[model samples]
Target chain A: MECLEVYAWLQAYLDSGVTAEQERAVEAHIRACPYCRRKLVAMARVVNALERTSDISPRADFTRRLYEALEEEAGHPLAPRPREPRR
Target chain B: MDLRLLERCRQGHLEAFGDLVSRYQSRIHTLAYRMLHSREEAEDVTQETFLNVYRALGTFQGERFSPWIYKIASNLCLDFLRRRRHSTVSLNAPIGPEGDIPREIADETQLPEDVALAGALGLDVQRAIDALPPKYRTVIVLRHIEDLTYEEIAEIMVLPLGTVKTRLFRAREILRVSLARSD
Candidate 1:
């Protein structure tokens, strides 16, 4: 595949969702081209960075706050039910 | 996503609903926070999502409640973004050159030490996500941060599968360019 096509399909190639033929073509192109290879590495770094994004927690009283909002919207508060054990 | 909790919620038990809230509040909040990049807005969006979900409990017939909840949360995030855009004057005109989607990539040195809850690299990536337009941001958040499938993302975004795939690929490409420029 050409460099531009390789660039276009690079994300899918990294995502492992590309067609086999496209994958082979991209792999060959990257092997032959430094710029595309650099793009691939950078793209991979970006994807890896996404997986590393830390979970953002709500406030300490998130549940209480949500219930308060719900209580206001719902006009009445519900009681907590017995939670079923997870399998 | 608990059927029993949902059933109890449908029966008008506030306690059952609270239990359901306990289950989803964190995940939903996380989704909102990632999408909005604002803790305050994220909190509001999370609360709004649960409120909408609670109000619509009787209408939800799906087996897994996650998709439905995610749909509501994402839509709310979009609405909030729209309102935010309309109300505020943008100090920065535009950033991304390749596309219309406004990309936000924060300078690492500029980021305060405290904001790097996910470390500098991770927070840099999150800032990149924050800069994405609402549509692209939603897809990236759902597919990457929230770890939902593309099909699930398509459902949440209410778009065709091909469109979602194309958008996601384009968004990744934009992110790639943004990161490449930074380096």
Candidate 2:
């Protein structure tokens, strides 16, 4: 396979979702090709970084806050009244 | 505790709605954070998502809650991204507290100091991800981080399978190039 096609297969191959036959072809190409291997490694690094990003847990009071917002919105008058025609 | 609570929520029980909020708030907030890369926005989006979900709960038919909740969060995230784009804002640019910075390639099991050093790189990588356009970023996060199948992502994104695959590939390429530039 050409370089672009192999690169296209790189993500699925890493994901281990490609068909076995196609997987063998990708594995063979990457094993023989240094360039494709490097591209795969770079992609893998990005995936690694994504996995390790900050946790960013929600606030402890989030439930309270959500209810408060819900209450506020619920309390609001729905449907604006029609204004009288201006002279 | 029971699906009956969800039914009550659908019927407009305030307490039931509160229960739903308590149950799903974390997951909603996390999805928002991952999507928007902004804590405040995530919080706001999560609240909005629950409120919207509550209003629309009667229409939800599936026994499983995951897809329904995710569908709401993803739609809000997509709309937010679109509006931000129209306004020409860079959502990936850093904002708010820097305390929860990510750890880089360094061993996660390392000493606190080493972990701190790695965090800077980790934060940079996340920012790079945040910088991605919504289409690509959504695919990357769903497929890799969220561990959702491409078929599921395609269903959620309402795109063809081939289109999803193309977006994911190009997203990875963009992230790779961004990392190389940083180094």
Candidate 3:
């Protein structure tokens, strides 16, 4: 495969979603081509950085604050439901 | 999605609504944060999202709840970004009592000291992401951070799958070149 073709399919190839025949062709091309190989490495680094970035939590009182805002909008206390109907 | 909780919510069970909030707050908050790049704004968006979710629960007829929640949150975040387009805030600006930056508040999984020590590179990556246009940023955050599939992202963004794929490819290419420049 030529460099343009490889570039077009690089993401799918790296993600391993490409067909087996396509994967083999891309792998063979990368093996023979140093430039394409370097491109792959660079792209891989970018993906790795993204994947390694941890999911961040909001502040300690995230739930509390959210509940409070919800209550204010609700205009009534968001208390647990009573088991029986209040006549 | 918890069908039981949804059913209870539809039945006017306040506790079930609370349960839904507890289950999705983190993810919805993270999505807002990544899209807006501001903790305060993200928190506001999260609150608004759940509130809207609660208000609209009666009309919800979808099999899954996640995409619906994300769709609401994404719209709110995008609107927030659009309104604040001219005014720019430093991502390093103090956002908490302890004087932590938005990025620091984002990754609370790490100790303060560890975040301080190793946060430079992470901050660079975030900066590159922040620099992306809102369209690209939304798809990248949904695809990578939220781990949503292309079809789900397309659904949430209300775009064609081909558009989502094209935008994601462009977003990654932008990140690649931006990070390379930073190095």
Candidate 4:
């Protein structure tokens, strides 16, 4: 029963949206169940790290270069269309 | 900025095409960069994505442009990843323009230590994500970083709801395991 509850809430917990009551219950369960606790921590850690990671913004001239490339491609007679036939 | 410009672009108004590129270029490039983890490939994919978008603009329904453009980019990335898998070449190794690599910037919000930790973690996370199968990686990126809902991911990937959820869960677990091993 407890495992079922944990499994159900695991994704939500990783997403950092577990309700207060649910968080309390899950933490209690983790304290008593080493296996579940380890799995929970690992999952939580990955998510936490991901959320904390720095965003690498693209180059300063990204937009300008994209336009240049798009213009170049748009001028082409053979640019690949979404529905174009493939060999 | 407006759909009418897109319409004009679709009608071969060159300036309107420039407008459309201005509007979506950043988004398309960012998506490509995140998916492929290589700036050069991302640039190539971004160019290709817009070329396809321009050609298909006439067929686009009055629906949201966000999902439409993303759908195109996602499909292209998937195909590229699949083709990469067939070859013995390693994509993880950097292959791009010489001496034009973008410098990594430290965020103002992060102190020295936090910035370092963030960079380290981000590199590992990206590596793990790159190692994932294209299908799983696509869903994960769309759902997590792109902040699309399950339904949206389903639409983007053209998969059923169950498959999207299953792939997302498995992708997260795979990332977790890979990151743990790296630690």
lDDT of each: 0.74, 0.69, 0.75, 0.66
Task: Give per-residue CA lDDT, model 4, range B100-137, as digits (tens).
Answer: 12123222342343233233456657666666766677
Off by over 4 Å in 1: A81-87, B12-15, B92-121
Cand 3, B chain, TM: 0.81
Residue-level lDDT of model 2, residues B1-183, one tens digit each, is 546777876665656655565566665665677777667788888878878876777787767566667777888998987788668744243233631222232322334432432323365565667667677777887776666788888877888999988888877887888787777
Compute the DockQ of candidate 2.
Answer: 0.21
Model 3 spans with C-alpha error above 4 angstroms: A81-87, B86-121
- Who wins the lDDT comparison? 3
lDDT of each residue in A8-65, candidate 1, tens digit only: 6777887688898888888889999998898888878877888666566676666667
What is the TM-score of candidate 2? Answer: 0.76
Candidate 3 on A1-87: residue-level lDDT in tens? 689877757777766668988888888999999988887888789877777655556666766776777788879887762222111
Error of 2 at B103 (Å): 24
Error of 2 at A72 (Å): 3.1
Candidate 3 per-residue C-alpha lDDT over B1-183 given as tens digits, one digit per residue, 9 for 90 to 100: 477898998887878877777677777877887777677888899889988987887888888888889999999988987777647664433344532223332332444533532323376777677677778888988988788888999999999988998888877877787777778
Best TM-score goes to which candidate?
1
RMSD of each: 3.8, 10.7, 7.9, 9.8
For residue B70, give model 2's deviation from the true position in Å.
1.6
Q: Supply DockQ values for each candidate.
A: 0.44, 0.21, 0.32, 0.20
Return the clash pairs for model 4, or none: none
In DockQ terms, which candidate is top? 1
